[model samples]
Target: MSKQDGSNRLVSGPEVDDSTATILHVDLDAFFASASLLARPDLIGRPVVIGHDSSRSVVTAATYEARKYGVHSAMPMSRALRLCPNAVILEPDFSLYSRLSKQVMAILDDTSPEVERLGIDEAFVGIGGLRRLSGGANRIGAELRARIRRETGLVASVGAASTKYVAKLASSRAKPDGLLVVPADAVIDFLHPQPVSALWGVGPKQQERLARYGLHTIADVAHTSQERLSAWFGEATGRHLAALAWGRDPRTVEEREHEKSFGHSHTFSRDITDRSEQEGELLRLATGVGRRLRDAGVQARTVTLTVRFHDFRTITRSRTLPEATDVTRVIVEAAWSMLEQLGEMPPVRLLGVRASAVQDASDHGLLWDDTETWGSAERAMDAVHDRFGAATVVPASMLRRERKRDDTGPSGGD
Candidate 1:
């Protein structure tokens, strides 16, 4: 946390040797909006907001220009419009964004095998073993930025440091497409004067509590005894904070781990009790989960459906499949069956679909000879869909509902 003027630069840890500290954090700039702008060059340099256009919708991403007018992702569209009336709001094209994210991840894969994808727009690549291959972290970061720009037409901010926290902070500091590096020797000098909020685990509530103890800055927290900090933050959080204050993190960049489950849920603008409508919503949720599983090259053996009643009480039910699958039809059927077990008419506020007991895609097997043949056919269809687009092919039921929805105009209640 090197202080310059009013800001603090992220510092490295003592365990990091000055000559060997090689960690990199990569963050795409205004990812969704930027990718949208790339597809539509006319929108470049303009204030772009990617999200639902409905008044009740929340923003998913806002360009830097939009940020100037106080527009930001996760903000209500109604408020964003009030803040920036002229801003161009676009519906989120998740399929396109997902495709582009795969492309970006592929680029990072070429750079380093030890890459941990944090989200669609960011990842950490360990270059500790690549010093001989790329000279140093600085050169590696520079090349990565250049490659991304040249290949994807997107700007990326990068931070190089010894620890994950420091690297992440450095990347945040190097926002709007920039790069920064923190050497090991400067860790304490760089971190001491910064606010405690600079530490990863220090959320607003924790910050307020620390402030009560006159521990506002990293220096203050660093000087405070670990026992005292633990008493305030509890054992785990306290220990974590103290270690971070000293610029200590032992996490490593590794392959993206397969999740135990894949799921998606939606909160309705208003609760409803129509069984047909609820079934339709469940199908959509199932489709979302299945798509994600296929995209990640994984399959789930158990399908779980969760129903949140209008009163907010939630119940979850799951069923194990005879065989793991990434097929949308298989998942949707399983979810529909689970929904049937919930009995009649209960107004629902939220519906969710979860696919758990995951396994590698290669682990999929056929239940019968005919099912094996269908599995090959399904794989072919998945390949075609992946190569073209999700909407290129879909279940007939989905197609009919989509057409009906389009005909009825946008879902008005948001």
Candidate 2:
């Protein structure tokens, strides 16, 4: 874990060698929290948590000061308040965040054309061919941090390394506005001491699995033979881990035309047991997913449903459609079908709908379109939403009753 106070932050020295560390990972520090604080400069140095001021709301983002008390994104607001009672609470401004993100990405685009955006607040920039144009990797990283701060009033931490794996890890170690460059020669020295969880794909369950074998750190994993690791974890994951453990990443940064998937999730104020209510929530989520698909001018061939039980155990199921579609009803039916297949489920704490395998809507022409009417109606509704507001035309089922403890926030995955 990184120190929230920046006491343990690392950066490349003036005379450091960055010739081989051309891959840069740039990440904004506390993006939502920082953007929300732009108008309230008085809260600059104090602890602040960004989320709705509701007991059921979850923390969308937290400043470093709030993070020191163990507050983090996706955590329940009630728990966060208990952790930092005096912390200031602010609502998230997603539109403001989107504007700032565009400004930051524009700066990155100006710096290098080979930029791969990971999300609204992070990107991978390849600067191997721009040494003469932009100076050393260290200089490029430093300039990026400075430019982001000046333009967007947001702090960015940059990491430079020969591979994406090490570069991303370096950025986390230099959090809260700092930069660190790990040259090709010193990659192992910079990687081995970190905990196993630092490795990509190593989540809590995987970390526990590694702990059972006494593999507590990257060094332990690096020292283990490929065959042994493969025997413990299957073939593909084992080989992938072994390569990353030795600071070997064969992948290069490539610009993605669009995101892989679009999804919307909602955590209920209380565990929901009523079947009709659960289905209604799923319908709401599918409506959101379908709207996003149509907005992107794409259609999804697959729909996936995610369910989190009251005990926190989660599961997902997916089904492919006969025809690609961006219609709300089609998406809702597919998601509900998957949910029905789960049999008798436990009380659901959260539900999510995702649309994947997306492609240009115009390309997916059909001989006989079964959803022509539904699609037309949805597009008409979309027009109404654009003219008036999103709430102008919602499904009658959603208007049956107002949820007293309703708490909705933007999903980071979106």
Candidate 3:
């Protein structure tokens, strides 16, 4: 029984009261796959997979039908094909997905000002203040789902509850195209019977740990003392689990003014064995991350490097600088330093660069900038690229590498 296939679906009946359920979690159903299907109406209810049809690629999205056959997003395309041999495979249309995402977010923004977008496919919306202007939370969720479908020809599922945790859980339970409203008075009843895996922090490893202690359900964790939980999982994690098990979530939906991190990643068509080529790709990724930080007027204190080997083994290393910076050279150097520490690397399939611990560039103190000259040159290059378009100004090494890659035919990366 796949938990995510809506086999254990629960929903509120028409007579259910939702006056106290003020929070809503709305999720687009099969977002990428559905968006790709908008142009191919004949494949409406069939098993569909959205991704590049390459064994090297990963599945970006899959319809519920495909999911029922054990195909899912982030799974390897080869494995997904093995699971659902007849599934309709389509390339991902990111631009189309973005447009629909904006349309959906705009509808939520119109309904309430307290919409917190989690990603392109889901968001948390608070409707407590709109009870009078709009209807109850359940009604508002239904109307919003209706509006999304009517306006975009896409399906959305909603979960409405008094707490964000319960609201998110409700939405997941009401997957595909359903609305579930869990009243405040019934929060405990709705939560306790669920499996331990349903809890926010419980992944497969956590589930095994919980099961070793016979904590297989939310009720088991709720019944266990926080002190004992603390003794087992340490103070913070134990307390967190106890609180969540009892349906206690104090978090509220709030708008974020800025992102906490910036990142970029590139996947290779083949396992990259050349050390110079690997370094070049890392530089390219760092350049992208730095450009985004500069564009956002932010500086990062930490840089992270992520490497995935051809065998799918992944590792991450991070370093914190004494001062925040938005310079590509600094980011590249930091990332390279971390990569060098790993000794000789195996063939890599993916490389990623991430910048975190970000702050407004204006807030950074100007004591002694190490890359001042290089930073100035980069800023000038940024201006030229902005005027002429990207790649108009790139490192000489990158230029040579691009020509070399072109000579070898397309390697398929973004």
Candidate 4:
């Protein structure tokens, strides 16, 4: 993993090596709020919270001012308002954000041919090819930030490092609007001092457990033996953490034509109490995900269902299939089963379905039963929807409801 070998020598720069710092993680500054406030120049430098204040709206993004008062993304709006009442709230405009995201991505694409988009607001660009033209990786990163600000009128924080994992953390440490570069040799030093939560897979619960074991920092995990980590977190996660703690990530950036996970979510205007309605919505989302998976020519081995209650408490459950599939019956069946495990539900505020562990359709082999019936049926449905319209075909249960809705529509004269 050393960057220097004969002709491939790492040129040492300030806090980074120009030759080794090929991977860069670029993240937009307070993406949603910043993009929306572009039209409202007066709102700059104020505490801004983005997302609706409806029954179950969660905070999508918050400005630095809002963040000071404990407001953060995924926090309930009610909680955020309690924390910072003076914060200016802006309803999210996804279309505007999407446009801005594309503009930023276009800049990155021009900067580096190998760009891996992580989300709408973040991407990792491999800058190895730009060495000669851009002087070095450090200059390429600086220019990237300068160009984005010059072209888009938005600030972007960038992190330059040897590995994607460290690069992502470096970018996060340079929040709001800043840049940080970690050299190949200093990757361990860069990772060790950070909080345990800084590790890739450590969540709130895992953090609490690690703290209980007196493992509060990445250095703690690094010092701890692999056997101990395995005993604490089980085999796979233990080994994963052990490797990461030493600043080891073998993954490389690749252009993804599609995301590893694709799904849809809907927040209800009113909380739904009816079990039938909840199941119906879950079915709809699952079916939608299945269609997208098949359309993209990918089979998903896992289905995850997310349900948020009226009080903003959320529960997510996932089911891994024995065989990957792009069939609606398999997806809906898995989602519904997982949803059932949440136990007696309260008034549901939102529902979501996601499909992950994706593989190309050509690589997926169908069992005899699925091939003969469900898969064929779904393919036919896909053909129908493609030729006619999305609403032309739906689940048998939703048909009657659609008819009822049409009947309730206003007459042509009225």
Best by TM-score: 1
- The number of residue pairs in model 2 that clash at the backbone is 0
TM-scores for all candidates: the values are 0.85, 0.77, 0.75, 0.67
Q: Candidates 2 and 3: which is better by TM-score?
A: 2
* lDDT values for all models: 0.75, 0.83, 0.81, 0.75
What are the per-residue Cα lDDT tens digits for candidate 2 across 197-300? 88998988999999999999999999999999999998998898899899999889998644568777877878988889989998887887787677667898
Between candidates 3 and 4, the TM-score winner: 3
- Name model 3 segments beyond 4 Å from true: 1-3, 274-305, 309-346, 355-414
> In angstroms, how far off is 229's CA in candidate 3?
2.4
CA error at residue 382 for candidate 4, angstroms: 22
Candidate 4 ranges beyond 4 A from true positions: 1-16, 260-264, 272-348, 351-414
Consecutive 10-residue window with the lowest summed lDDT within model 2: 405-414
lDDT of 4 by residue, 1-414 (tens): 000111211222354555788899998877777776887889998988777765356677777767778787777778889998998888665435544666888898888789998777788998877788776667877788899889888877788888999888877776657778887888887789888988997888999999999999999999999999999889998999999999899999998654587676767767778877778877877776777677566888898888889999998888899888888888888887887777688898778888899888788567747544887888899788767756778887765443111000000000
Q: What tens digits encode model 3's per-residue C-alpha lDDT throughout 1-414?
A: 122666777777767899889899998877777887898999988998877677777777788888889887667889999999999988654435545777888898899999897766788999999988888976798899899999999888899998899998898898868899998889999999999988997898999999999999999999999999999999999989999998899999997534678776767877888888878888877877787677667899999989989899999999998889999999999998898898888898888889999998988675445677777788888788767756688887787554211011101110
Judged by whole-model lDDT over C-alpha atoms, candidate 4 comes out at 0.75
In model 2, the Cα lDDT at residue 323 comes to: 81
Top-scoring candidate (lDDT): 2
Worst 10 residues of 4 by lDDT: 405-414
